[model samples]
Target chain A: MLIQRLAIIGVGLIGGSLARALKRANAVGEVIGCGRNINNLQQAVELGVIDRYDTNPAQAVTEADMIVVAVPLGTIASVFAAIRDNLSAQAIITDVGSAKATVVADARQHLGNYLPRFVPGHPIAGTEKSGVAASFAELFEQHRVILTPLQETDPQAVATVSTMWTQTGAEVIEMSVTHHDEVLAATSHLPHILAYSLVDTLAKMAERTEIFRFAAGGFRDFTRIASSDPQMWHDICLANQQAILQILDSFKTDLTQLITAIQQNDSQYIATVFSRAKSARDKFCG
Target chain B: MLIQRLAIIGVGLIGGSLARALKRANAVGEVIGCGRNINNLQQAVELGVIDRYDTNPAQAVTEADMIVVAVPLGTIASVFAAIRDNLSAQAIITDVGSAKATVVADARQHLGNYLPRFVPGHPIAGTEKSGVAASFAELFEQHRVILTPLQETDPQAVATVSTMWTQTGAEVIEMSVTHHDEVLAATSHLPHILAYSLVDTLAKMAERTEIFRFAAGGFRDFTRIASSDPQMWHDICLANQQAILQILDSFKTDLTQLITAIQQNDSQYIATVFSRAKSARDKFCG
Candidate 1:
């Protein structure tokens, strides 16, 4: 087995999917889930996502060779602190948080001697849905998993985490913690912010009813991310505040230029921006 | 057949799809296509999207009982003028433009005495992909077709256009020309602007490669409309300038508020906006 006694703290969509995927690959011997929701934990056990369930973080990580911290970004520090004193010296630790610079800093502050064994990761896979019930074994198939290992982190620990993700059918990529945070801020976090803001703005308009009634496939696809978990996104915005704000500022500047072009009917300027964006989006995005 | 002779000017995605859907339903006979690209027109005929092809709009509309002007919004005036004198006196004319008020004005200026027979309609359908190659008979299935018929427009002409849309399996609704423009600005036009702006902003950043490389499903779905035809959108922005500018102002206000909330780390404000948007999006959009 690739992992013996794998403990998943805050076992929601990300953690549950990891456990299910590892178990399906026959790469994990024992899976223990810990979460705030008792019913969810019970459901996870019944579905074979975990071999057992625990309520205490200290007890969940007891003798676990590997521990996965899959909580929201705001709670990552506390989660790290809770299991720090309970982990074996040889144990390797990791997290699946979207923001990485803060996670790496939190690990430095709370992981104590286990800092070198901590490998931070963010899997670029998920639906708008949350919780254990929404997870599946093939969630990471053909997906990318980014790992951000700090300078003090052990190479062996990074390799172990990389192998674990590879076993789940994910392509593992490594980058600096700061780069991960900044890049994610531009791509994922900023899009969520824009989607939420646009939807809220439209909902408050006098033509809200008719606007939604006549919306087509394009608008639906454009706002699909607005249905994401608000609490999770709230934490993300605050955790990656600096990088997100920087990218958000850039977007606003470009938006201002676009609005001005539209107002003045500068067809050439507007077309240039739209054409460039179309080329980039078609080349890079799905 | 519901239409004996139908002429489609500027036969592209919208016009080709309409022709294909009507022919599939046996609702039209002797469909003739006209466009700047002779190869595209020939391909339309080969795919059975049209029964014949014509390079001249005036000749294409000769003796035709119904004509669908499916050109870009900026070209709508010229296309109307091209066929105005050649159309049969009893011919019913309609358009598939996204913006309605400008189209109504264009019809008034160029359609001559046929203004009463002009139906200003917008089919709430289409993908980012353009041209007849991407067109399909099922494109309008389960979609909406909004018809903004003026007071001077004949009820018989409106009924004929509505029946044509209905035969394509689309639900047809009628509204004022002004209302259609405003609502479309919020739901469709505004979203496209935001998407194009965001993609352009990221592409201009120094970290463009990394930003796009890490873009996940959410970003892909959020920016899908960024790949839409730039010329069409350029025409739309100018044609629907007033409404788009007004909605764009509202979006900017909300976005500025969101940026401030993120900067201050105001958890409650961010959460409220995201939550409200999630609920509204889940309730209204797919």
Candidate 2:
């Protein structure tokens, strides 16, 4: 009921799931799926994620009133460039990239006149899986959708994008692109980096075989994100390099201090760190 | 059927759960729960985890055919020193400590001749919650139980401990105490350390109030172990300091390399790391 013509570029998990959710909610008129993979487009159509499919990003944009680019962070610039001229004069464009600063900057660079309607957005929801087959309408339900709009971005476009996400059951919040990058670096980017690093270190150890077998539930749960799309995480780390590095430095400083306390048998210091961490986890995580 | 006159020290989660499992399997004739906490002992008896209770560790060990020391790792030495003269001459002693080498060495220092029967064992299963109230009979069902016996450990005593654990539906395996520490440094200790560190960092951030509200499923799953018993993790980190530090150093090196790859825009290196980690996770964790 809210959107008339909706085009989803790179119809993978996020795009396909959004398409399905729009159909389920009856929030959009016509849904179009666009991607480089012809098979994925056909599969999306067969799966009814979209009413139709198109391999041409520009052609797909021309037939839509709104476009949602759901691709890896590194590819957002190219996708925007490809469809910038084709998007309807009044069409609102958004993205589901993990990093917003780089993507916003890329949109500004690629689409000069269209910058006001390029409402950069990120849905804080994902699984350790990818592709159209992994999508579901409820994927965005109860999730956070952060919109990072430049000062030049039109308020009207931002409201439309925010309302669209709200229709899909997401809570929308506005944030500066830089702050979004830093906040997510601590909350999301750093955790994935640690998971991949730990797994890589364990693999290099001589006890890798037995270590893997005995990993059990805790290790499995802790490292679950390491199984995510490698290309996607790689793009995220690169796009948000400075912020992720800052967080990693902070993490190392804290870890080293805790290690030193243990080495010196500083039970009081250890207890304080442990107690504070426990209280925070209980309060925030619960 | 596999044990007799079993004495369980500490009468908390692991201890109470073991007693409950033994009773359910009818593997022991008389089960005794010992702890400084009088209420915990009464509660354990009320919950049918123990046939009887003892406030004094020595009195609890006097008639036991086997003794299972399930106190915190930091208290293992003092517990052994207190019960050294009370343990039955033919009794086989084992512990359910996370760190094996330190506990085994402490037992050796205090129990001397009885050290050969003091086989160190670790049940690789636990919940984030603690205490007698959170325990259950099937806590160790189909779980891995690793026995780290010293070179001078009695083969017969090792067999007895293995049989007891097997009766509780745990698959018992043998490993060197040093190897056990190193492997667990990666599998359990490091994961916990990272979780605690991440939670602490996020809770102290400027946007914590807002971020905590929007923390979706991924953040919740990643930090689930951060809610574990802080005292328990503190003991584990301190007891396994050397191995844990080594693993932390290894993880830091791997993370530094990843950071460098991201900074330099080395997509190939980043992609390779991700692919290898993804494959390793799929093969080992899935």
DockQ for the candidate 2 complex?
0.72
Write the residue-wise lDDT of candidate 2 on A146-240 in tens digits: 99988989999999999988888888988889888888888888888888887888887876888998997888888999899999999998999
DockQ of each: 0.89, 0.72
lDDT score, candidate 1, position A248: 91
RMSD of every prediction: 0.9, 1.5
Task: Give the number of the best model, judged by lDDT.
Answer: 1
Docking class of 1: high
Which pairs of residues collide in candidate 2? A1-A27, B1-B27
DockQ score for candidate 1:
0.89
Query: Tens digits of per-residue lDDT for model 1 on A1-286?
Result: 7798899998889999999999989999999999888999999999889999898898999999999999999899988989999998689999999999889889989998899999999999988989998989999988999998888989999999999999999999999878888888898988989999999998887767777888889888889999989999999999899999989998898999989988887888999999999999999974
Per-model TM-score (chain A alone): 0.98, 0.97
